[model samples]
Target: MVNKNAGDIQSLTRMNQLYEKLLNEVDVGIHVINEKGKTIIYNKKMMEIEAMASEDVLDKNLLDVFMFRESQNSTLVKALKTGKTTKNIKQTYFNNKGKEITTINHSFPIKEEGRITGAIEIAKDVTQLERVMKENMLNKQNGKITFDTIIGRSQLMETVVDEAKRATRTSSSVLVVGETGTGKELFAQSIHNGSNRSRAPFISQNCAAIPDGLMESLLFGTKKGAFTGAVDRPGLFEQADGGTLLLDEINSLEPSLQAKLLRVIQDKSIRRVGDTKDKEVDVRIIATINEDPLDAVANNRLRKDLYYRLSVVTLFIPPLRERKEDILLLTQAFIDKYSTLFNMDVKGISEGVKTLLQQHNWPGNVRELEHTIEGTMNLIMGEDVITIQNLPGRFRSRYQAEEEPLVQGDEGDLSESNQTLHEKMTKVEKMYIQRVLKNNGHNITRAAKILGISRQSLQYRLKKFGL
Candidate 1:
């Protein structure tokens, strides 16, 4: 029995030696502190990360060795005090030599027989990662808008925004389908900004803007001497590694390029236009199509396989004509915007101008409306309110052309309209409300805004009308 006990002790000593050797050889920094806050074990990687020698850190109090602000909030100290564990905490601190170090730390308490004896921390340095992200070209684009900047109160717009916010929580490929000028890129930017990869690059490429001959090299990179004047250059896929790539108007790509894109997405690697080797990339793809994606697929403009791969998450933005409830809200926002830009004191739109705006169809969507307001604001000399007379000539002509025929028909139909004034007005109101609701895809919140009524009031009317 004594000989068996002696053999167990020998085995324990050998196990401890192996554990110590394994800890020292790991790439991540490892640190251990006793319950008394004394450094018990500090691996070689930890020494290199802190730029300190073994003698300086060994057997020293953790607070005394670091002597920095982050020491007070150290995960190791916190774990020791609370007998709890903390994982994946990003920390930054200045070491003893006053050099800044940033790391992601995972710390846990060391328990012995239902009591906390010490704590161990494993840290991964991320300073170099930050440096590499900042060097990417996509990070250089200025005035990038986040989800916060997107403004819309209409129910249709709210639904789109909600779906977009949900998409940000994943690494799945996103496909945004909308008409031209429906703010597809804006939605793409919002998703990118809200994602975990926000700190990395957000490179955008309009597939239609680049010709087919050069598109391959521009997207997948090229080797030196691949073609005349072609030097070795990383493409958008390589540049956007660890980030997001916005492929605008993806349907414009030829079917062959679409096949290549699918392979890259499936294989997680790409071969340069003329290179024999394949390069791996970690990039999230956010594709935008200016038309209906299903229609594009049916028409063979987009590859079916590629469409399915990119459409793992899809967001559809309704056009301005379809969501007319947002027109006044957007108009007010634009007025504020151009007011600041053109240095105007315009505060509101006249009732007549508002009626005219509601009657006209905004075929070009939000982008067109913004430009219209900007142009009008530039022409306003000192008006505080924009009246119908102040509107552009083209807009006034279009409004007159549509209104004249409507007025003429109404005059001719008065003999047939024998109902009381109150009855006729109520009938017109109900008809208009129904039309607005249909236009907004039966979204009550949006229809309410178009009808200038509260949601509760709209609901009451909807019930009263049996709609």
Candidate 2:
């Protein structure tokens, strides 16, 4: 009888150990609380998810330990009180340390002989999962263009491209300076693709797109309990490990955040929002600015220190107006692209249309040219060549305005003796302003730049002449 009892005891002990091991090995967090809300069991996975140890929670009241607001409404409490199961319900709350936690929970009442005993809650950490999905989407949308598709042959553009190619040979940070729509992100991606880390991820984020409050955590990561609803998750720096991170519109970042960015660049390490330890990351940063970076620093929009670190290899992408020689080349490339995309018979732009295109300054650069071509291709049908009629309304109006004669009668008839000095001067000024405006695509900023006047001054003159 004694031997049989010993064998049975040993078997039960082994069974208990197996049960404990299985519970801890599972991915989901498991917690069991008695009918009185006292914690009865908490698995190892649960401890890790909560950023706590098992000893801290065992045999304690759930309400006392977590202090979850409105414990009566909690899934575990509700399941125990109502004797009903809550399956796959999503919950978000702040833990004791004020960190945000999100989880999909399944809570069930533990019963014996149809009597309520306790409640068991199973939670799956979804904060990390959601972050991973967001990063994956960004990766899918980046690195679609390469150097070969850049499509510019002007000396200014050639220099920019050459400098960009040279930048890819090293791991130093690159700063691309250009106006909006000048393909800064494209250059950044090309550099990444041409680098040794081409096989790794290429992540791009517009600094202006994210709110200032969330910028720090988004770029440097957040530790569990960093703030209300904060969860342990990797930031862009960590996500771009062994890869490239493109920060578009770096000047838009708040100055305080810029200082933090400088530290990250200098140290090659980032500490999560609530973390005490620094994590080393091997990421190549490529920052872009739409405005002159030095001007931005002078205006207090960007930190000077951050600028120096990021501009290790600055590549200045010339505005389309500055690279006028490449206008036809870019236009042809865009025409071919849109024609193939729309499955249209459009062969090319007419000489008249080409002349009109060359006359107008492209404020939006290559992107604007591509959009114009795409718009024209969508409207063309049964036509081999794009003409003035196929152009956008703005272009058509500008062309018509240019085509109109300056004076109603012959120039010889409207001699200097026919008008006063002021009248003749006013007429000439109006004509000159109109010509300048047309040349600059009616963009006040570019027109002002070419006219050697302030944009506000140009606006005043434009209003005066109604040009």
Give me the candidate number with maximum TM-score.
Answer: 1
Count of residue pairs whose backbone atoms collide, per candidate: 0, 3
Q: Per-residue CA lDDT of candidate 1, range 215-307, in tens?
A: 999999999989898889999999999999999999999999999999999999999977999889999999999875666877999998998
Mind giving the per-residue lDDT tens digits that candidate 2 earns over 371-417?
88888877775577999898878657855753433355532223433
Which regions of candidate 1 deviate over 4 angstroms? Answer: 1-142, 402-467
Pairs of colliding residues, candidate 2: 99-225, 100-229, 100-230
Q: What lDDT does the true structure give each of the candidates?
A: 0.82, 0.81
- The number of the candidate with the highest lDDT is 1
> Which residue pairs show collisions in model 1?
none
Q: Could you estimate the TM-score for every candidate?
A: 0.57, 0.56
Scored by lDDT, model 2 comes in at 0.81
